[model samples]
Target: MGCTGPLAELGGGETVRRAMDVNFLGMLRLVRAVTPSMAERRSGCVVNVGSVVGTAATPWAGVYCASKAAIHAATDALRLELAPFGVHVVKVVPGRVKSGIGRANTAQIAGGHGGKPREWGMYREFTAAIEERARASQGAGATEASALARHVAERVMRPRPPREIVYGSLTALFAVLAASPVWARDAFFARRFGLNRKL
Candidate 1:
């Protein structure tokens, strides 16, 4: 559940709303539906899949990052809330994995406006960078989906699973950035995402 576009665009609000609806509300609905039974039984685990982007906002995918951040925050809250009932809530933050998300996002953008970010106002010069950001997670160094799944499954099946599982490619780097000073983090993202230049 993600979206790619400048935050000031014509349809930006719609994009943000859709991302939140799918990524946050969708997960919340499922959790709500199952938690009552789990609470009554005094057993069960709720694993929420989040992303490294949730920890730190990136340039073009702000809305997508926000959605994942919501998941991460909710997972943390739920962990404490459901602990007394023996329900374990785990936050799975994957950095980057070989998934269909990139393709889906590309298709979504194409379907929305012919995949032409160059035509967008104020962001025209950033077309290439924006396009790259859209597919950034699907790069060559991305971890295999099977590998991530295996690691997560193994840890989760343990006698006591971790409160949060952080795995996949670039997880370490993101962790560092997440802990870095706000100014430094901002500088790093600006340079990395081609936002350092004047438009």
Candidate 2:
């Protein structure tokens, strides 16, 4: 299951709820609706498409990252629970596979203000940077969707599917960040997102 949107410019309640609905709850609803049949059949593969940011909270996109992180955790639990039923739960963590998510995110954020900048409490000056961060994954060196699809397809078809699959641009960098100390991660993201500097 794949889903996403921009939440950096939205208020706390709206941002968190929107991200949770799309990134985490949507998958839960899908599994709830479909898992019974799969369990009955005693064979199935569920592939969840998450993001590298889910592994580590990045500045400016905390809501979206939180939702993805929930998916990562849920997927782990799902993998364990479904194994005995011959159901394979695969978590595909994509760093930045080329897609229209960036455009959609930009559109979603802009829709709230007719494509004009809206008042962003406390983060007023960093609006552009936040927008850039939303589209950052689509920049140069992003992995093509076809390649990611092929890789996932090949893996899921195996006798023993991987519990977690990580790929796409900046996958390694983000993985390292996810494994780093909290202080290091905070410092890195603060600097990268201009949070450490005065706007």
Candidate with maximal lDDT? 1
Model 1 per-residue lDDT tens digits across residues 1-199: 7688777773556667888999999999999999999999999989999999999999988889988999999999999999999998899999999998898777666665555433568888887788888899999899999999999999888868899999999999999999999999999999998999875
Per candidate, the number of residue pairs that clash is 0, 0
Clashing pairs in 2: none
lDDT of 2 by residue, 32-146 (tens): 9888899999999899878898898777677777888899999999999998999999999988889887886676556544666345677777778777777877899999999
Q: What local lDDT score does residue 157 receive in model 1, on the 0 to 100 scale? A: 85
Candidate 2, which segments miss by more than 4 Å at Cα? Answer: 1-9, 112-116
Model 2 worst lDDT window (10 residues): 1-10
Give the whole-model CA lDDT for all candidates, comma-separated.
Answer: 0.88, 0.80
Give lDDT: candidate 1, residue 67: 88
lDDT of 2 at 5: 29
